[model samples]
Target chain A: MIQWAADVSMLVIGVSLLLSLWRVLIGPSVPDRMAALDAATANVIAGIVVFAIRDDTLDYIDSALVIALLSFVGTVAVAKFLAKGVIIERDSD
Target chain B: MSEILTSLLILTGAFFLLVGTLGLLRFPDVYNRLHSVGKASTLGVVSTLLASVVYFWAQQSTLSVKQLAIVVFLYMSSPVGTHMMARAAHLIGIPLAKETQRDDLKKRRGSVPANE
Candidate 1:
Protein backbone atom coordinates (compact mmCIF):
# COMPACT_ATOMS: atom_id res chain seq x y z
CA MET A 1 0.00 0.00 0.00
CA ILE A 2 1.12 3.57 -0.63
CA GLN A 3 0.51 4.48 2.98
CA TRP A 4 2.74 1.72 4.20
CA ALA A 5 5.54 2.68 1.89
CA ALA A 6 5.40 6.32 2.85
CA ASP A 7 5.41 5.41 6.50
CA VAL A 8 8.47 3.23 6.12
CA SER A 9 10.22 5.96 4.23
CA MET A 10 9.36 8.42 6.93
CA LEU A 11 10.94 6.11 9.42
CA VAL A 12 14.09 6.05 7.31
CA ILE A 13 14.10 9.82 7.24
CA GLY A 14 13.76 9.81 11.01
CA VAL A 15 16.79 7.57 11.30
CA SER A 16 18.77 9.96 9.18
CA LEU A 17 17.62 12.75 11.41
CA LEU A 18 18.98 10.92 14.40
CA LEU A 19 22.30 10.76 12.65
CA SER A 20 22.20 14.48 12.04
CA LEU A 21 21.39 15.01 15.69
CA TRP A 22 24.41 12.95 16.60
CA ARG A 23 26.59 15.22 14.55
CA VAL A 24 25.02 18.24 16.14
CA LEU A 25 25.91 16.88 19.55
CA ILE A 26 29.37 15.46 18.88
CA GLY A 27 30.64 17.71 16.15
CA PRO A 28 34.10 18.97 17.04
CA SER A 29 33.63 22.41 15.49
CA VAL A 30 30.91 24.98 15.14
CA PRO A 31 30.42 24.62 11.38
CA ASP A 32 30.07 20.89 11.78
CA ARG A 33 27.37 21.39 14.33
CA MET A 34 25.56 23.97 12.24
CA ALA A 35 25.74 21.75 9.21
CA ALA A 36 24.05 19.08 11.25
CA LEU A 37 21.32 21.52 12.15
CA ASP A 38 20.79 22.31 8.51
CA ALA A 39 20.50 18.66 7.73
CA ALA A 40 17.98 18.32 10.51
CA THR A 41 15.90 21.04 8.92
CA ALA A 42 15.95 19.22 5.64
CA ASN A 43 14.78 16.09 7.37
CA VAL A 44 12.03 18.01 9.03
CA ILE A 45 10.93 19.25 5.65
CA ALA A 46 10.69 15.74 4.36
CA GLY A 47 8.82 14.68 7.45
CA ILE A 48 6.41 17.54 6.98
CA VAL A 49 5.67 16.44 3.47
CA VAL A 50 5.09 12.92 4.62
CA PHE A 51 2.75 14.11 7.32
CA ALA A 52 0.84 16.25 4.86
CA ILE A 53 0.41 13.30 2.59
CA ARG A 54 -0.78 11.09 5.39
CA ASP A 55 -3.13 13.54 7.04
CA ASP A 56 -4.45 14.97 3.80
CA THR A 57 -4.01 18.51 4.99
CA LEU A 58 -2.25 21.50 3.48
CA ASP A 59 -1.60 23.23 6.78
CA TYR A 60 1.54 21.21 7.39
CA ILE A 61 3.04 22.66 4.27
CA ASP A 62 2.81 26.15 5.72
CA SER A 63 4.68 25.05 8.80
CA ALA A 64 7.32 23.44 6.66
CA LEU A 65 7.90 26.69 4.81
CA VAL A 66 8.19 28.57 8.04
CA ILE A 67 10.68 26.09 9.42
CA ALA A 68 12.68 26.19 6.22
CA LEU A 69 12.90 29.97 6.26
CA LEU A 70 13.75 30.21 9.94
CA SER A 71 16.39 27.51 9.61
CA PHE A 72 17.95 29.36 6.70
CA VAL A 73 18.25 32.56 8.67
CA GLY A 74 19.40 30.77 11.80
CA THR A 75 22.05 28.68 10.06
CA VAL A 76 23.40 31.64 8.11
CA ALA A 77 23.56 33.85 11.17
CA VAL A 78 25.35 31.18 13.14
CA ALA A 79 27.76 30.47 10.32
CA LYS A 80 28.55 34.15 9.94
CA PHE A 81 29.20 34.45 13.61
CA LEU A 82 31.52 31.46 13.54
CA ALA A 83 33.39 32.82 10.54
CA LYS A 84 33.83 36.47 11.47
CA GLY A 85 33.11 36.42 15.22
CA VAL A 86 30.28 38.85 14.60
CA ILE A 87 27.06 38.66 12.63
CA ILE A 88 26.88 42.39 11.90
CA GLU A 89 28.46 45.42 13.47
CA ARG A 90 27.25 48.89 12.64
CA ASP A 91 29.77 51.63 11.95
CA SER A 92 30.69 53.59 15.07
CA ASP A 93 33.89 55.24 13.97
CA MET B 1 -3.11 12.27 -17.11
CA SER B 2 -2.62 14.26 -13.93
CA GLU B 3 -2.53 11.25 -11.67
CA ILE B 4 0.23 9.63 -13.66
CA LEU B 5 2.29 12.79 -13.73
CA THR B 6 1.78 13.43 -10.05
CA SER B 7 2.65 9.86 -9.23
CA LEU B 8 5.88 10.01 -11.16
CA LEU B 9 6.86 13.29 -9.60
CA ILE B 10 6.22 12.08 -6.09
CA LEU B 11 8.16 8.87 -6.73
CA THR B 12 11.15 10.72 -8.02
CA GLY B 13 11.01 13.17 -5.17
CA ALA B 14 10.87 10.38 -2.64
CA PHE B 15 13.80 8.65 -4.28
CA PHE B 16 15.92 11.76 -4.06
CA LEU B 17 14.96 12.31 -0.43
CA LEU B 18 16.00 8.78 0.31
CA VAL B 19 19.34 9.37 -1.31
CA GLY B 20 19.77 12.59 0.63
CA THR B 21 19.10 10.76 3.87
CA LEU B 22 21.60 8.09 2.95
CA GLY B 23 24.21 10.66 2.16
CA LEU B 24 23.59 12.43 5.40
CA LEU B 25 24.16 9.23 7.29
CA ARG B 26 27.06 7.88 5.29
CA PHE B 27 29.21 10.85 4.37
CA PRO B 28 32.20 11.39 6.61
CA ASP B 29 32.99 15.07 6.28
CA VAL B 30 30.77 17.98 7.26
CA TYR B 31 31.12 19.91 4.01
CA ASN B 32 30.72 16.79 1.94
CA ARG B 33 27.60 15.84 3.85
CA LEU B 34 26.23 19.31 3.41
CA HIS B 35 26.72 18.99 -0.31
CA SER B 36 24.89 15.71 -0.19
CA VAL B 37 21.94 16.93 1.85
CA GLY B 38 21.77 20.44 0.40
CA LYS B 39 21.74 19.67 -3.31
CA ALA B 40 20.01 16.30 -3.20
CA SER B 41 17.32 17.19 -0.69
CA THR B 42 16.59 20.55 -2.23
CA LEU B 43 15.84 18.93 -5.55
CA GLY B 44 13.74 16.29 -3.83
CA VAL B 45 11.67 18.72 -1.78
CA VAL B 46 11.12 21.09 -4.68
CA SER B 47 10.07 18.32 -6.95
CA THR B 48 7.69 17.01 -4.34
CA LEU B 49 6.22 20.47 -3.85
CA LEU B 50 5.79 20.83 -7.57
CA ALA B 51 4.04 17.50 -7.61
CA SER B 52 1.76 18.60 -4.83
CA VAL B 53 1.07 21.79 -6.72
CA VAL B 54 0.14 19.78 -9.75
CA TYR B 55 -2.01 17.42 -7.76
CA PHE B 56 -3.86 20.19 -6.02
CA TRP B 57 -4.19 22.04 -9.27
CA ALA B 58 -6.46 19.28 -10.44
CA GLN B 59 -8.45 19.38 -7.22
CA GLN B 60 -8.31 23.11 -6.41
CA SER B 61 -5.98 25.29 -8.40
CA THR B 62 -5.27 28.14 -6.01
CA LEU B 63 -3.89 26.25 -3.03
CA SER B 64 -1.16 24.37 -4.82
CA VAL B 65 0.19 27.59 -6.27
CA LYS B 66 0.88 28.75 -2.76
CA GLN B 67 2.81 25.55 -2.17
CA LEU B 68 4.68 26.10 -5.40
CA ALA B 69 5.60 29.60 -4.32
CA ILE B 70 6.96 28.22 -1.07
CA VAL B 71 8.97 25.69 -3.02
CA VAL B 72 10.35 28.45 -5.23
CA PHE B 73 11.48 30.45 -2.25
CA LEU B 74 12.97 27.39 -0.62
CA TYR B 75 14.79 26.37 -3.79
CA MET B 76 16.31 29.81 -4.15
CA SER B 77 17.33 30.16 -0.54
CA SER B 78 18.67 26.70 0.33
CA PRO B 79 21.66 26.72 -1.99
CA VAL B 80 22.71 30.26 -1.21
CA GLY B 81 22.47 29.48 2.49
CA THR B 82 24.49 26.28 2.20
CA HIS B 83 27.23 27.87 0.14
CA MET B 84 27.48 30.78 2.52
CA MET B 85 27.76 28.45 5.46
CA ALA B 86 30.38 26.30 3.78
CA ARG B 87 32.53 29.24 2.78
CA ALA B 88 32.10 30.67 6.25
CA ALA B 89 33.30 27.41 7.72
CA HIS B 90 36.38 27.50 5.54
CA LEU B 91 37.10 31.10 6.45
CA ILE B 92 36.81 30.25 10.11
CA GLY B 93 39.77 27.88 9.76
CA ILE B 94 37.86 24.64 10.11
CA PRO B 95 40.37 22.14 8.85
CA LEU B 96 39.58 20.34 5.68
CA ALA B 97 39.91 16.62 5.35
CA LYS B 98 43.42 15.17 5.36
CA GLU B 99 43.21 14.07 1.76
CA THR B 100 42.36 17.56 0.56
CA GLN B 101 45.07 19.26 -1.43
CA ARG B 102 45.88 22.50 -3.19
CA ASP B 103 43.94 24.94 -1.08
CA ASP B 104 44.73 28.11 -2.99
CA LEU B 105 43.38 30.27 -0.21
CA LYS B 106 45.74 28.70 2.27
CA LYS B 107 48.62 29.01 -0.14
CA ARG B 108 47.82 32.63 -0.92
CA ARG B 109 47.51 33.49 2.71
CA GLY B 110 50.80 31.70 3.50
CA SER B 111 49.12 29.74 6.24
CA VAL B 112 49.93 26.28 5.02
CA PRO B 113 53.55 25.30 4.42
CA ALA B 114 55.13 24.64 1.02
CA ASN B 115 55.41 20.86 1.40
CA GLU B 116 51.79 20.61 2.43
Candidate 2:
Protein backbone atom coordinates (compact mmCIF):
# COMPACT_ATOMS: atom_id res chain seq x y z
CA MET A 1 0.00 0.00 0.00
CA ILE A 2 2.80 2.42 0.77
CA GLN A 3 4.55 1.59 -2.45
CA TRP A 4 1.39 2.66 -4.17
CA ALA A 5 1.84 6.09 -2.64
CA ALA A 6 5.41 6.26 -3.88
CA ASP A 7 4.25 5.61 -7.42
CA VAL A 8 1.43 8.11 -7.09
CA SER A 9 3.77 10.74 -5.77
CA MET A 10 6.11 10.24 -8.65
CA LEU A 11 3.23 10.79 -11.03
CA VAL A 12 2.16 13.95 -9.23
CA ILE A 13 5.66 15.36 -9.21
CA GLY A 14 5.97 14.68 -12.89
CA VAL A 15 2.77 16.55 -13.56
CA SER A 16 3.87 19.42 -11.35
CA LEU A 17 7.13 19.68 -13.22
CA LEU A 18 5.22 19.83 -16.45
CA LEU A 19 3.01 22.60 -15.13
CA SER A 20 6.02 24.64 -14.12
CA LEU A 21 7.46 24.23 -17.57
CA TRP A 22 4.23 25.44 -19.02
CA ARG A 23 4.35 28.55 -16.88
CA VAL A 24 7.89 29.17 -17.95
CA LEU A 25 6.90 28.99 -21.58
CA ILE A 26 3.78 31.13 -21.39
CA GLY A 27 4.81 33.73 -18.84
CA PRO A 28 4.07 37.17 -20.32
CA SER A 29 6.91 39.25 -18.91
CA VAL A 30 10.52 38.88 -17.95
CA PRO A 31 9.83 38.78 -14.22
CA ASP A 32 7.02 36.30 -14.72
CA ARG A 33 9.32 34.11 -16.72
CA MET A 34 11.97 34.48 -14.08
CA ALA A 35 9.54 33.47 -11.35
CA ALA A 36 8.44 30.47 -13.38
CA LEU A 37 12.02 29.45 -13.99
CA ASP A 38 12.79 29.73 -10.30
CA ALA A 39 9.80 27.58 -9.52
CA ALA A 40 10.88 25.07 -12.11
CA THR A 41 14.31 24.86 -10.57
CA ALA A 42 12.79 24.20 -7.18
CA ASN A 43 10.53 21.55 -8.68
CA VAL A 44 13.46 19.82 -10.27
CA ILE A 45 15.34 19.83 -7.00
CA ALA A 46 12.45 18.18 -5.19
CA GLY A 47 12.01 15.65 -7.96
CA ILE A 48 15.67 14.71 -7.91
CA VAL A 49 15.76 14.18 -4.17
CA VAL A 50 12.65 12.05 -4.14
CA PHE A 51 13.77 9.92 -7.05
CA ALA A 52 17.23 9.52 -5.61
CA ILE A 53 15.81 8.38 -2.32
CA ARG A 54 13.62 5.90 -4.14
CA ASP A 55 16.65 4.55 -5.98
CA ASP A 56 18.96 4.75 -2.95
CA THR A 57 21.67 6.98 -4.34
CA LEU A 58 23.73 9.75 -2.80
CA ASP A 59 25.14 10.96 -6.10
CA TYR A 60 21.95 12.65 -7.20
CA ILE A 61 21.59 14.37 -3.86
CA ASP A 62 25.02 15.95 -4.20
CA SER A 63 24.25 17.17 -7.67
CA ALA A 64 20.90 18.40 -6.46
CA LEU A 65 22.71 20.48 -3.88
CA VAL A 66 24.97 21.92 -6.53
CA ILE A 67 22.01 22.70 -8.70
CA ALA A 68 20.29 24.39 -5.81
CA LEU A 69 23.26 26.66 -5.22
CA LEU A 70 23.75 27.48 -8.87
CA SER A 71 20.12 28.12 -9.57
CA PHE A 72 19.81 30.52 -6.65
CA VAL A 73 22.75 32.59 -7.81
CA GLY A 74 21.57 32.55 -11.36
CA THR A 75 18.09 33.75 -10.48
CA VAL A 76 19.46 36.49 -8.28
CA ALA A 77 21.86 37.61 -10.95
CA VAL A 78 19.25 37.77 -13.63
CA ALA A 79 16.72 39.50 -11.45
CA LYS A 80 19.24 42.05 -10.23
CA PHE A 81 20.40 42.75 -13.72
CA LEU A 82 16.89 43.18 -14.95
CA ALA A 83 15.99 45.40 -12.06
CA LYS A 84 19.01 47.67 -11.84
CA GLY A 85 20.96 47.04 -15.04
CA VAL A 86 23.87 45.63 -13.03
CA ILE A 87 24.71 42.58 -10.96
CA ILE A 88 27.62 44.05 -9.02
CA GLU A 89 28.27 47.73 -8.46
CA ARG A 90 31.31 49.31 -6.88
CA ASP A 91 30.50 52.13 -4.48
CA SER A 92 33.72 53.89 -5.46
CA ASP A 93 31.82 55.85 -8.08
CA MET B 1 9.07 0.96 8.60
CA SER B 2 11.25 2.84 6.16
CA GLU B 3 9.13 2.08 3.15
CA ILE B 4 5.85 3.26 4.59
CA LEU B 5 7.28 6.39 6.09
CA THR B 6 9.27 7.30 3.01
CA SER B 7 6.35 6.71 0.71
CA LEU B 8 4.00 8.75 2.86
CA LEU B 9 6.40 11.63 2.99
CA ILE B 10 7.09 11.57 -0.70
CA LEU B 11 3.40 11.46 -1.46
CA THR B 12 2.65 14.42 0.77
CA GLY B 13 5.54 16.37 -0.68
CA ALA B 14 4.42 15.61 -4.18
CA PHE B 15 0.93 16.86 -3.41
CA PHE B 16 2.19 20.30 -2.35
CA LEU B 17 4.48 20.45 -5.34
CA LEU B 18 1.59 19.72 -7.62
CA VAL B 19 -0.45 22.53 -6.12
CA GLY B 20 2.47 24.91 -6.26
CA THR B 21 3.01 24.19 -9.91
CA LEU B 22 -0.65 24.63 -10.58
CA GLY B 23 -0.51 27.96 -8.81
CA LEU B 24 2.49 28.95 -10.83
CA LEU B 25 0.63 28.37 -14.05
CA ARG B 26 -2.69 29.85 -13.00
CA PHE B 27 -1.77 32.75 -10.74
CA PRO B 28 -2.62 36.20 -12.11
CA ASP B 29 0.65 37.88 -11.18
CA VAL B 30 4.26 37.09 -10.58
CA TYR B 31 4.28 37.81 -6.85
CA ASN B 32 1.23 35.67 -6.25
CA ARG B 33 2.80 32.89 -8.24
CA LEU B 34 5.92 33.13 -6.12
CA HIS B 35 3.84 32.54 -3.03
CA SER B 36 2.70 29.25 -4.51
CA VAL B 37 5.90 27.98 -6.11
CA GLY B 38 8.45 29.40 -3.72
CA LYS B 39 6.74 28.87 -0.37
CA ALA B 40 4.73 25.73 -0.92
CA SER B 41 7.32 23.86 -2.94
CA THR B 42 10.01 24.66 -0.43
CA LEU B 43 7.98 22.99 2.27
CA GLY B 44 7.27 20.13 -0.08
CA VAL B 45 10.94 19.44 -0.68
CA VAL B 46 11.64 19.39 3.04
CA SER B 47 9.04 16.73 3.58
CA THR B 48 10.45 14.59 0.80
CA LEU B 49 13.96 15.01 2.16
CA LEU B 50 12.80 13.97 5.60
CA ALA B 51 11.42 10.87 3.98
CA SER B 52 14.82 10.11 2.53
CA VAL B 53 16.45 10.62 5.90
CA VAL B 54 14.04 8.20 7.48
CA TYR B 55 14.68 5.63 4.81
CA PHE B 56 18.45 5.79 5.20
CA TRP B 57 18.45 5.83 8.98
CA ALA B 58 16.12 2.86 9.14
CA GLN B 59 18.74 0.79 7.39
CA GLN B 60 21.27 1.50 10.18
CA SER B 61 23.12 3.82 7.84
CA THR B 62 24.85 6.80 9.38
CA LEU B 63 24.12 8.91 6.30
CA SER B 64 20.74 10.19 7.36
CA VAL B 65 22.43 13.28 8.71
CA LYS B 66 23.51 14.26 5.24
CA GLN B 67 19.98 14.04 3.95
CA LEU B 68 18.70 16.04 6.88
CA ALA B 69 21.30 18.67 6.26
CA ILE B 70 20.34 19.04 2.65
CA VAL B 71 16.69 19.25 3.63
CA VAL B 72 17.47 21.96 6.10
CA PHE B 73 19.62 23.85 3.65
CA LEU B 74 16.97 23.82 1.00
CA TYR B 75 14.32 24.91 3.45
CA MET B 76 16.39 27.84 4.60
CA SER B 77 17.50 28.97 1.17
CA SER B 78 14.43 28.53 -0.99
CA PRO B 79 12.29 31.19 0.65
CA VAL B 80 15.12 33.68 0.97
CA GLY B 81 16.00 33.35 -2.66
CA THR B 82 12.40 33.60 -3.72
CA HIS B 83 11.83 36.64 -1.57
CA MET B 84 14.89 38.33 -2.95
CA MET B 85 13.78 37.64 -6.46
CA ALA B 86 10.25 38.85 -5.83
CA ARG B 87 11.40 41.95 -4.04
CA ALA B 88 13.66 42.68 -6.93
CA ALA B 89 10.76 42.27 -9.27
CA HIS B 90 8.51 44.61 -7.32
CA LEU B 91 11.22 47.23 -7.12
CA ILE B 92 11.60 47.19 -10.88
CA GLY B 93 7.96 48.16 -11.49
CA ILE B 94 6.75 44.88 -12.81
CA PRO B 95 3.10 45.17 -13.66
CA LEU B 96 0.55 43.74 -11.29
CA ALA B 97 -2.64 42.11 -12.34
CA LYS B 98 -5.41 44.41 -13.54
CA GLU B 99 -7.71 43.20 -10.81
CA THR B 100 -5.35 44.00 -7.97
CA GLN B 101 -7.13 46.55 -5.77
CA ARG B 102 -4.38 47.53 -3.39
CA ASP B 103 -0.65 48.07 -3.88
CA ASP B 104 0.99 49.02 -0.64
CA LEU B 105 4.37 49.22 -2.27
CA LYS B 106 3.14 51.92 -4.61
CA LYS B 107 2.12 54.04 -1.64
CA ARG B 108 5.55 53.93 -0.10
CA ARG B 109 8.27 56.50 -0.81
CA GLY B 110 11.91 55.51 -1.50
CA SER B 111 10.88 51.95 -2.01
CA VAL B 112 13.86 50.38 -3.82
CA PRO B 113 12.98 49.56 -7.44
CA ALA B 114 12.70 49.21 -11.65
CA ASN B 115 12.58 45.95 -13.62
CA GLU B 116 10.83 47.05 -16.80
Candidate 3:
Protein backbone atom coordinates (compact mmCIF):
# COMPACT_ATOMS: atom_id res chain seq x y z
CA MET A 1 0.00 0.00 0.00
CA ILE A 2 2.79 2.40 0.88
CA GLN A 3 4.59 1.39 -2.26
CA TRP A 4 1.57 2.18 -4.37
CA ALA A 5 1.24 5.55 -2.68
CA ALA A 6 4.87 6.29 -3.35
CA ASP A 7 4.43 5.43 -6.99
CA VAL A 8 1.41 7.72 -7.35
CA SER A 9 3.04 10.59 -5.56
CA MET A 10 6.14 10.25 -7.66
CA LEU A 11 4.06 10.42 -10.79
CA VAL A 12 2.36 13.58 -9.64
CA ILE A 13 5.66 15.20 -8.72
CA GLY A 14 7.13 14.20 -12.05
CA VAL A 15 4.34 16.05 -13.80
CA SER A 16 4.88 19.09 -11.64
CA LEU A 17 8.58 19.09 -12.44
CA LEU A 18 7.84 18.96 -16.12
CA LEU A 19 5.41 21.84 -15.88
CA SER A 20 7.98 23.96 -14.09
CA LEU A 21 10.48 23.03 -16.76
CA TRP A 22 8.05 24.22 -19.39
CA ARG A 23 7.80 27.56 -17.63
CA VAL A 24 11.57 27.79 -17.48
CA LEU A 25 11.79 27.17 -21.20
CA ILE A 26 9.15 29.71 -22.21
CA GLY A 27 9.37 32.31 -19.49
CA PRO A 28 9.54 35.76 -21.11
CA SER A 29 11.48 37.66 -18.48
CA VAL A 30 14.54 36.91 -16.37
CA PRO A 31 12.64 36.93 -13.06
CA ASP A 32 9.99 34.67 -14.51
CA ARG A 33 12.67 32.18 -15.40
CA MET A 34 14.23 32.58 -12.01
CA ALA A 35 10.93 31.89 -10.29
CA ALA A 36 10.47 28.78 -12.41
CA LEU A 37 13.96 27.63 -11.55
CA ASP A 38 13.31 28.17 -7.88
CA ALA A 39 10.11 26.17 -8.05
CA ALA A 40 11.94 23.43 -9.89
CA THR A 41 14.58 23.23 -7.19
CA ALA A 42 11.91 22.93 -4.54
CA ASN A 43 10.22 20.21 -6.52
CA VAL A 44 13.47 18.33 -6.83
CA ILE A 45 14.11 18.51 -3.12
CA ALA A 46 10.64 17.17 -2.43
CA GLY A 47 11.31 14.37 -4.89
CA ILE A 48 14.51 13.49 -3.08
CA VAL A 49 12.74 13.33 0.24
CA VAL A 50 10.03 11.10 -1.20
CA PHE A 51 12.60 8.84 -2.78
CA ALA A 52 14.46 8.51 0.50
CA ILE A 53 11.28 7.61 2.32
CA ARG A 54 10.33 5.04 -0.28
CA ASP A 55 13.76 3.46 -0.14
CA ASP A 56 13.67 3.39 3.64
CA THR A 57 16.98 5.19 3.85
CA LEU A 58 17.99 8.30 5.75
CA ASP A 59 21.17 9.19 3.86
CA TYR A 60 19.50 11.06 0.98
CA ILE A 61 18.29 13.74 3.35
CA ASP A 62 21.82 15.10 3.37
CA SER A 63 21.73 15.58 -0.37
CA ALA A 64 18.44 17.43 -0.05
CA LEU A 65 20.04 19.70 2.53
CA VAL A 66 22.98 20.45 0.30
CA ILE A 67 20.74 21.15 -2.68
CA ALA A 68 18.53 23.48 -0.66
CA LEU A 69 21.53 25.44 0.60
CA LEU A 70 23.12 25.75 -2.81
CA SER A 71 19.90 26.75 -4.51
CA PHE A 72 19.22 29.46 -1.95
CA VAL A 73 22.68 30.89 -2.44
CA GLY A 74 22.31 30.80 -6.19
CA THR A 75 18.92 32.48 -6.09
CA VAL A 76 20.16 35.23 -3.80
CA ALA A 77 23.21 35.86 -5.94
CA VAL A 78 21.15 36.14 -9.05
CA ALA A 79 18.65 38.37 -7.34
CA LYS A 80 21.39 40.66 -6.07
CA PHE A 81 22.81 40.91 -9.53
CA LEU A 82 19.44 41.70 -10.97
CA ALA A 83 18.78 44.36 -8.38
CA LYS A 84 22.19 46.01 -8.19
CA GLY A 85 23.80 45.07 -11.49
CA VAL A 86 26.61 43.48 -9.48
CA ILE A 87 26.65 40.41 -7.28
CA ILE A 88 29.41 41.73 -5.01
CA GLU A 89 29.35 45.46 -4.45
CA ARG A 90 32.72 46.98 -3.65
CA ASP A 91 31.42 50.13 -2.00
CA SER A 92 28.21 51.44 -0.53
CA ASP A 93 28.08 54.21 -3.11
CA MET B 1 -2.54 3.20 10.23
CA SER B 2 0.60 5.31 10.09
CA GLU B 3 1.11 4.31 6.48
CA ILE B 4 -2.28 5.75 5.58
CA LEU B 5 -1.41 8.99 7.24
CA THR B 6 1.94 9.18 5.54
CA SER B 7 0.40 8.44 2.17
CA LEU B 8 -2.22 11.12 2.61
CA LEU B 9 0.43 13.67 3.46
CA ILE B 10 2.50 12.71 0.47
CA LEU B 11 -0.46 12.91 -1.89
CA THR B 12 -1.51 16.30 -0.57
CA GLY B 13 2.03 17.59 -0.91
CA ALA B 14 2.15 16.41 -4.49
CA PHE B 15 -1.13 18.20 -5.20
CA PHE B 16 0.19 21.46 -3.84
CA LEU B 17 3.36 21.10 -5.88
CA LEU B 18 1.34 20.58 -9.02
CA VAL B 19 -0.72 23.66 -8.30
CA GLY B 20 2.40 25.73 -7.74
CA THR B 21 3.95 24.63 -11.00
CA LEU B 22 0.72 25.30 -12.82
CA GLY B 23 0.68 28.80 -11.41
CA LEU B 24 4.28 29.32 -12.43
CA LEU B 25 3.35 28.35 -15.94
CA ARG B 26 0.11 30.32 -16.16
CA PHE B 27 0.58 33.49 -14.14
CA PRO B 28 0.93 36.55 -16.32
CA ASP B 29 3.76 38.47 -14.71
CA VAL B 30 6.87 37.82 -12.68
CA TYR B 31 5.53 39.18 -9.42
CA ASN B 32 2.28 37.23 -9.69
CA ARG B 33 4.22 34.15 -10.65
CA LEU B 34 6.50 34.61 -7.68
CA HIS B 35 3.52 34.93 -5.39
CA SER B 36 2.09 31.66 -6.60
CA VAL B 37 5.28 29.63 -6.70
CA GLY B 38 6.65 30.92 -3.43
CA LYS B 39 3.73 30.15 -1.15
CA ALA B 40 2.43 27.01 -2.78
CA SER B 41 5.75 25.33 -3.34
CA THR B 42 6.98 26.08 0.15
CA LEU B 43 3.89 24.51 1.61
CA GLY B 44 4.24 21.57 -0.74
CA VAL B 45 7.86 20.92 0.06
CA VAL B 46 7.28 21.24 3.77
CA SER B 47 4.39 18.84 3.61
CA THR B 48 6.44 16.28 1.75
CA LEU B 49 9.29 16.61 4.22
CA LEU B 50 6.87 16.13 7.07
CA ALA B 51 5.60 12.98 5.45
CA SER B 52 9.11 11.61 5.21
CA VAL B 53 9.78 12.53 8.81
CA VAL B 54 6.67 10.67 9.83
CA TYR B 55 7.57 7.65 7.76
CA PHE B 56 11.06 7.45 9.23
CA TRP B 57 9.81 7.87 12.77
CA ALA B 58 7.20 5.18 12.27
CA GLN B 59 9.74 2.75 10.87
CA GLN B 60 12.56 3.36 13.31
CA SER B 61 10.72 4.74 16.33
CA THR B 62 12.99 7.79 16.21
CA LEU B 63 12.88 11.17 14.54
CA SER B 64 15.32 12.16 11.82
CA VAL B 65 17.05 15.36 12.74
CA LYS B 66 18.27 15.94 9.21
CA GLN B 67 14.74 15.87 7.79
CA LEU B 68 13.62 18.38 10.36
CA ALA B 69 16.61 20.57 9.57
CA ILE B 70 15.76 20.53 5.89
CA VAL B 71 12.20 21.58 6.66
CA VAL B 72 13.38 24.38 8.89
CA PHE B 73 15.89 25.60 6.34
CA LEU B 74 13.30 25.54 3.57
CA TYR B 75 10.75 27.45 5.60
CA MET B 76 13.28 30.16 6.37
CA SER B 77 14.91 30.47 2.97
CA SER B 78 12.16 30.06 0.41
CA PRO B 79 10.32 33.23 1.41
CA VAL B 80 13.51 35.23 1.59
CA GLY B 81 14.52 34.02 -1.80
CA THR B 82 11.13 34.85 -3.27
CA HIS B 83 11.19 38.32 -1.74
CA MET B 84 14.65 38.94 -3.11
CA MET B 85 13.53 37.86 -6.54
CA ALA B 86 10.52 40.16 -6.40
CA ARG B 87 12.63 43.10 -5.25
CA ALA B 88 15.08 42.39 -8.02
CA ALA B 89 12.31 42.40 -10.55
CA HIS B 90 11.08 45.72 -9.27
CA LEU B 91 14.57 47.23 -9.17
CA ILE B 92 15.27 46.12 -12.70
CA GLY B 93 12.03 47.72 -13.99
CA ILE B 94 10.14 44.69 -15.06
CA PRO B 95 6.77 46.13 -15.93
CA LEU B 96 3.63 44.86 -14.32
CA ALA B 97 1.08 43.07 -16.43
CA LYS B 98 -1.29 45.24 -18.42
CA GLU B 99 -4.16 44.33 -16.16
CA THR B 100 -2.43 45.35 -12.96
CA GLN B 101 -4.70 47.44 -10.75
CA ARG B 102 -2.37 49.72 -8.83
CA ASP B 103 1.19 50.85 -8.17
CA ASP B 104 1.30 51.33 -4.43
CA LEU B 105 5.07 50.99 -4.32
CA LYS B 106 5.49 53.65 -6.93
CA LYS B 107 3.19 55.94 -5.00
CA ARG B 108 5.02 55.23 -1.77
CA ARG B 109 8.49 55.64 -3.28
CA GLY B 110 7.49 58.98 -4.83
CA SER B 111 7.72 57.88 -8.44
CA VAL B 112 10.72 56.38 -10.21
CA PRO B 113 13.05 58.84 -11.92
CA ALA B 114 12.54 59.26 -15.66
CA ASN B 115 16.01 57.83 -16.38
CA GLU B 116 15.43 54.63 -14.48
The numbered model that scores best in DockQ is: 3
Best-performing candidate as measured by lDDT: 3
Q: Could you arrange the candidates by lDDT from highest to lowest?
A: 3, 2, 1
Task: Give the DockQ of candidate 1.
Answer: 0.45
Q: Against the true structure, what is each candidate's TM-score?
A: 0.84, 0.89, 0.94
What overall lDDT goes with each candidate model?
0.73, 0.77, 0.89
Q: TM-score for the first chain of model 2?
A: 0.88
Clashes of each: 0, 4, 0
Native contacts, share recovered per candidate: 0.37, 0.69, 0.89
lDDT of 3 at B17: 94
lDDT of 2 by residue, A7-59 (tens): 68878888888888888788877777877887777778778887777666666
DockQ of all models, two decimals each: 0.45, 0.66, 0.79
Candidate No. with top TM-score: 3
Question: Residue A9 deviation, candidate 2, in Å?
Answer: 1.9
Candidate 1 residue-wise lDDT at B37: 70
As a whole number from 0 to 100, the lDDT of residue B89 in candidate 3 is 89
Per-residue lDDT over B1-116 for candidate 3, one digit per residue giving the tens place of the 0 to 100 score:
88988998998898999999998988889999999988999899999999998898899988888888988898899889999999888877899999999988667656666224
Q: What interface RMSD does each of the candidate structures achieve? A: 3.5, 1.9, 1.4
Candidate 1 lDDT, A5-47, residue by residue in tens: 4566567667768877887888777777777788778778877
